[model samples]
Target: MAVNLQKGQKISLEKEAGGALSRVTMGLGWDVAKSGGFFGFGAKSQAVDLDASVVMFDESNRPVDVVWFRQLKSRDGSITHTGDNRTGAGDGDDEQIVVDLRTVPESVRSLVFTVNSFTGQNFSTVQNAFCRLFDTSNGKEIARYDLSVQGSHTAQIMAKLYRHNGEWKMHAIGENGSGRTFDDLMPLIVPHL
Candidate 1:
């Protein structure tokens, strides 16, 4: 069974999945809100180019590597991105980042998942945005975070997966910010780590 996570909620992956997980995927999805054309004539939906990224951080909260649309994989090959989804069209996850947890370097302490509109479209133009984590071994969703807040911000610091006492855990971080890329999200992410 999948757990719906609230903002700031934390969960132990081991307990939620019934055991240890070797691989997991962070999936992000969203839809573009329709705009009422001149005098409500033609309501149309524009394509939203939202990019999902994962920033690997070390023990001191320093970024070790990042896997995003531009860089599809981490330096060590432990993390891989499923590519960018410019339209946010169709169903399910628009973008996905897969992590081989076992192969992640010991020096990398946390993985921060983030979503941003490379096209500069704010959240007000988006709808039904969400981030989810699932066990890759059995294709079971373990946790999901719905981004229900709509605003002028262009990006969001979605969630964090970190190691705690040799066990993996997840934290829901629904912080909104204005950014077109991962570099712009660095400051907003530091406080959460």
Candidate 2:
């Protein structure tokens, strides 16, 4: 079953499985604010100073994995202060999260992805956020969740994996607040599990 996530919550993916997941993939997508106008008018704006990441934790909720940790750049080479569109404008800003679930400690139980303002003061708003979990054994999407804007500049989204009645389950969590770095996300993550 899929879990309903509120803004600013984290869900553990490996709670009662008795071991770590074999493989996991996570993806996030969002719309950037348009540029050249006072209210998203005129020219299309880019999210230049955006930072996205996915962190994995053990059953004990310890740090285990990190992915997509960097500042985004424009792929088309258009330098008008607009942000980079990696997959073209039509696809939106999409990032992937892949984790070798087998490598995660058996004590760990979940994974988290926190989006933030990377350029200090630029691109502080999160227009939209979505996440999907995939099973590596067969490259299948097991579950998905759409993040709701909680009026915060940053958000800590979580996905938990566990076994229920002989079937695996994923729970998604959406937490709000400004968490630009991994250290900032730790505090918000520990208590959620």
TM-score of each: 0.96, 0.61
> Candidate 1's residue-wise lDDT over 118-178, tens digit each?
9998999999999999998888999999985889899999999999999999999999998
lDDT of 2 by residue, 1-193 (tens): 4444444443445443233556666655666555466565576555534445655565566775554444332122110112322421346336555555444444445545565555433333345556666554565555566653535455454455543344345555565555556567678767665
**Best-fitting candidate, measured by lDDT?**
1
Collision count for each candidate, in order: 0, 22
Error of model 2, residue 44, in angstroms: 4.1
Top-TM-score candidate index: 1
Worst 10 residues of 2 by lDDT: 73-82
The parts of candidate 1 lying over 4 Å away from their true place are: 37-41
